[model samples]
Target: MTDEPALDSARKPVPAGTPDADSAAAPWWTRAVVYQVYPRSFADSDGDGVGDLGGIRAKLGYLAELGVDAVWLSPVYPSPQHDNGYDIRDYQDIDPVFGSLAEFDALLAEAHERGIKIVMDLVVNHTSDEHDWFQESRSSRTNPRRDWYWWRPAAADGGPPNGWRSAFSGPAWTLDGATGEYYLHLFARQQPDLNWENAEVRRAVYAMMNWWLDRGVDGFRMDVINFIAKRVELVDGPRPSVDGGSPMGPQIHDYLQEMHREVFAGRGGEHLTVGEMPGVSVSDAVLFTDPARAEVDMIFQFEHVSLDQGEHKFHALPLSLPALKKSLSRWQDGLADTGWNSLYLNNHDQPRLVSRFGNDSEYRYESATLWALVLHLHRGTPYIYQGEEIGMTNVRFDSIDDYRDIESLNHFREAVQEFDRSPAAVLAGVHTMGRDNARTPMQWDASDNAGFTSGTPWIAANPNFPGINTVADRAGERSIFRFYQRLIALRHESPVVALGAFSMLEPEHEQLYAFTRTLGDETLLVVANASDAPLVGPLPVDVTGGDLVLGNYAGADGSGLRPWEARLYRL
Candidate 1:
């Protein structure tokens, strides 16, 4: 399915609430606020300079107090650190840098004890070349596990099997002299794409998933899940393509259905499964998330976040607020009937929200608070990336040498060395969209290293952490952290915020993102001045009888909204 129209709510028999009757029973994930913990950057307990499970365990109380129902830990599994844990070396064990299995268990126990669930990052599309399976597959062509990863003879022209290129800017196929074959890798060469067509591979994946489920992992945030099934014929991608978008393969649904049958069938609907779909449209997301099909509960779509990127993520442009409203409103309506959306402004993969989307300098507090109101008040589940609750801004290192992300390093190399691009422009782009922006250490206090570690950190902490940290924010009553707490509390208290029918109020307004959330007789108006300038608009209807439910500022002036003001009203 391509881009389907916004779901028709009139066809629904259930009261006009969020989702259908099937998913509305969503015991947890529906209205839950999920906090994503980049394990390596969260907090370093033992002073190994890297964050560990012990650190997360010690901080469970903080997350519980933050009002989040769950924490989505970005891959803590064993890896060679090639892609900061995405290139998984072991699926079952915790990385030594993070901690051991015992520590993970303790962390999980503490999280659950505090009424918080933990969902693991599932990276099934590929595995680290150092993994035993990949090692065995690469050992010999006749090995039983040789087909575990995609392997093929070189093309007639003595090149890769197809014109495929890696998402990080290299040939997608890597030649292995030992076997005289090319293996496909959409990412780093060390991350070989798995041969999902092989039933053994599928079974192995299913078994791994079951192991996690039985081990009490509440759910999974499957990474690049849409790329699990590629075009079986191995046809070349479109000309001059970069292997970045979601792989729209014909057998994708079949594989998902099989996965559900084998892994999620008897588990019931309590588990949350959110697919991180890179290029999936609104309609495809519906197919993936409709609970009746037992596929997934929600999906993280990239279109809205990608609006500011010009063609590539590295090339940045000022975002258009109206366009952003149009895109977000479509998804809100598109999935109103069949599925749900995962709301986020920042994550481990993207830049910080205040830096990229909101005004981070003069009106940082107001803008960040405005964002908290806008994102959490939406129709679907909301995700708060580590440090986003405190309004963490992007970091700009003096040079690229300080950057550790493989994607950033690779693109910087391509930009300066191969393309003859100006280093200044390239560096600026990296500062704007680099994954390192969100990878900075969590700012907990004003002490050395932001109190993240007693020793040197693996990555440098943002220099501005002293002022924009948890301790500082907590001391100050009206800070971004407190605003986020209020937002989460609203989600728990107001069913109108949880299951309201979403509709954009003033779609044509340039600097205003105004929308209405309706649930039966209650209708809540959400208006935010998404810019640094005051906005004056005509009052089409008087909001006299409504209660001023939530706002960043205390008193309403009645005439207009000040710069970066966000308010919610319920009638």
Candidate 2:
């Protein structure tokens, strides 16, 4: 492990969002839009039914033309595929299924040549049980590396250390047959949680991070970063809630600050870092992302995404537009003067945005563009998941065998066999909330396998790919892809869109999602009808009078918004 310096407690903290003398020029990410590529489903180049780095290199032109400033690849590192690459076996090596290290370097260079940066997904919260570090740790109770992971003795009753549940639906602790101890795994048993309490573990992680930065990687989107610091005493928590005595331990900020100092202190201003923080409150987010703290540039919060979830993520409920607006508005206002927000509706772990939040049926185009318009105009950095620009919908697999995500499959078994759930009802929930919905191969064209691969795809393509593929959308008159392009361009062209103060309008109106962005002398107003029916109501006079900057429908004269209609105005 590398030698790391301790954090400076005597240093005074700077005010949130306060720029220093050297930072007169804005950072690249403030106005930049990022696109996420789940590599296995992006494109296949080897005809092995799996996407690889070479496949991404072949599509650089498409992403460059799409106007994304950065491409965030989700976990291309070597893994056992237990959690779809999240269970990393090697931190520095690319998975053989994805390609080799040389191929990744080539892709990075090509992306840089095309004026797009590469951001790797950092998944250090846990390591695959097959990882060299964990293998040595679990070799024996008295091994030198035994403390690298959380290994606890069996309870008096000979059960798990606690009653906490796994995110995939089982005991959070898995008993190790060799060592006669249970190892903590917040996720799948194959993924054992690393003990951050060990200084060597922290140093090792920082060293690995510095290695990536030295290799010219732009930044990282840290996975489950908030869970790195765990409670010292692993006590029992509420049943079936996966709390395990609150995973958000007190030292999270300290660990992040130390990580920033050791890994990113002198790495220049071009790099971007965003943490995926579940259950992070607005106040905590401000502290985590405040520039003075040197923790991260931004964070991906789950409050807005958890709006429609009941009890758990798979137990779906109807989305309330007003509630969604309120949740988003709170974050907007909370971080307006402090931390930055990462705006996104879809990602690898979530369902499609169009299918979940917008009308994916008759008004797919309108609703897709409407959602994009609303999200990009907010005062934050926006992210576009693969196939989101083409308005991809959720897939309804007839049987559980067609799904490939471990989360979905595990939940089905636990629900039906363990909890006595109806198979039909469980399948229905899976259709709406399954992670597999976003993992389907990217629909590039209307060809066999949706042009994602020449051979059979690892997962089945959405049957609606014939009509919803990118080729058709790019060639159509009312193109969702074009709409996204314009939105990205607008963010780059206007400072008001990136650094404006957000103000939510008509927060109680169930059908209208309205907001304003104000920066200095300029103000931008965004209005959209989030319902299926046309909205006929009296709007503000200034909104009707402002110049129309962008709209989803033609000749939207501010008289009233059509079904799923959206418009941006410069007031």
Question: Top lDDT: which candidate number?
Answer: 2
TM-score for each of the candidates = 0.95, 0.95
lDDT (tens digit, per residue) of candidate 1 on 1-571: 2122122222122323643434445446666899999999999999989998989998888898889999999999999999999999999999999999988888888888898999999999999999999999999999999999988887777888777778888898899999999998989999999989899999999899999889898989999998888876544433334443445586787887777777766565567788987788898988887765657778999999989989788999998988898999999889887878899998999999998888889988889989889988888899999999998999999899999999999999998999999988999999999999999899999999999999999989999999999989878967888888889998888777778788887888888888888876778888888988888864434677778888888798445788999988886
Q: Across residues 184-286, which tens digit of lDDT does each residue of candidate 2 receive?
A: 9989999999999899999999999989989999999999999999866554332233444557788898898888778876555567889998889999888
Question: TM-score of the candidate numbered 1?
Answer: 0.95
What residue pairs clash in candidate 1, if any at all? none
Q: What's the true lDDT of residue 134 in model 2?
A: 98
lDDT of 1: 0.85
How well does candidate 2 match the true structure, expressed as C-alpha RMSD? 3.1
lDDT (CA) for every model shown?
Answer: 0.85, 0.88
- Can you tell me which runs of candidate 2 are displaced by over 4 Å? 1-25, 235-245
